[model samples]
Target: MNSKKLALIQTAMKLFYRKGIHAVGINEVLKVSGIAKKTLYHHFSSKDDLILACLHYREQLFIDWFKQQLDAVPAGKAAILAIFDALDSWFNNRSPAMGEFNGCFFINASAEYGREDSLIYAACQQHKSHVRAIIKPHVDAFEADENKSNQLTDSLCLLKEGAITTAKVQAKLSAARDIKPLAASLINHPLRQANI
Candidate 1:
């Protein structure tokens, strides 16, 4: 993509994420991005196409950041905690400075698109499975038992999904703080140890 198109996509994502997808329009994005109409259409066929590109870009950026955090922490339970650690940074800085401190981009878009065929929906689905895979290795590293990792990955994903929704609806931005105890409980559980 050209620098202008890339800039437009990046700016649009930030705007859409901070403001709901429905609330944002092409004119607003164009005005904010300061990109010309011909340029925008030359790169993106339509608003839907642009939205898809934005979603894909956001997904890639998030995954890259997530992987970097995981690498910074130790493997297994320690690495799993890193996910929460990264979330904590968001919890700490919930304000206009960083834009909307709402919740997961996937969750927001999913609610908006309702599992439809839109690119946002497809990107959301792809992004979620990618997230699960990222945590799979850490879960698998728990003990001698191979399956425990898969189980742990599921449990962690559930916890994450709930956390995102709960934090958004309840206005408890620091909700990730709750995950530590839950994660610890899972890590130190008797059934998990017994399986090994």
Candidate 2:
């Protein structure tokens, strides 16, 4: 995409991430982004298309940042802790790419765009699955059985979601750190038999 098109996506994403998908209007995006309606329509056929573009844009950005954070730590329990650590910075708006998080953008968008068939909702699901993919490697190493690995990933994902939700609601980004202990417990569980 060209600078103007990318700018529109970024602007709209920030607005949608801060507010909500339905709460934000096309005119508001255009006005805030300083893009003309004709140009926006030229780039995206409709508001929904624009929203999808923004989701795609954000999905890439979010995953890249998340992977970077995960990479900073070795693949082990520390790697899992790295996720909550990253969430701390993200919730606190410490990342330049992410302003003060209203919550997980995908989670927020999914709540509003709940219809199973909606592209926006599908994008949300895809983003979450991508997150799981990123996390699976760390969890997989801790569990020899495939089913146990999947279960571990699911548990970790829930802890992450819970941490994000708690952080947002409690008005303290550090609240996400609470997940660390629970995560450690899961990682060090007796049944796992793997060194965390």
Off by over 4 Å in 2: 190-196
lDDT of each: 0.79, 0.87
Candidate with best TM-score: 2
Model 1, span 147-181: residue lDDT tens: 66567677888887787777788877677888778
Q: Considering summed lDDT, which 10 consecutive residues are worst modelled in model 2?
A: 187-196
TM-score, candidate 2, is 0.94
The runs of at least 3 residues in candidate 1 whose Cα sits more than 4 Å from the true structure, single-residue gaps closed, are 94-100, 144-146, 190-196
Lowest lDDT 10-mer window, candidate 1?
91-100
Following a full C-alpha superposition, what root-mean-square deviation does model 2 have from the true structure?
Answer: 2.5
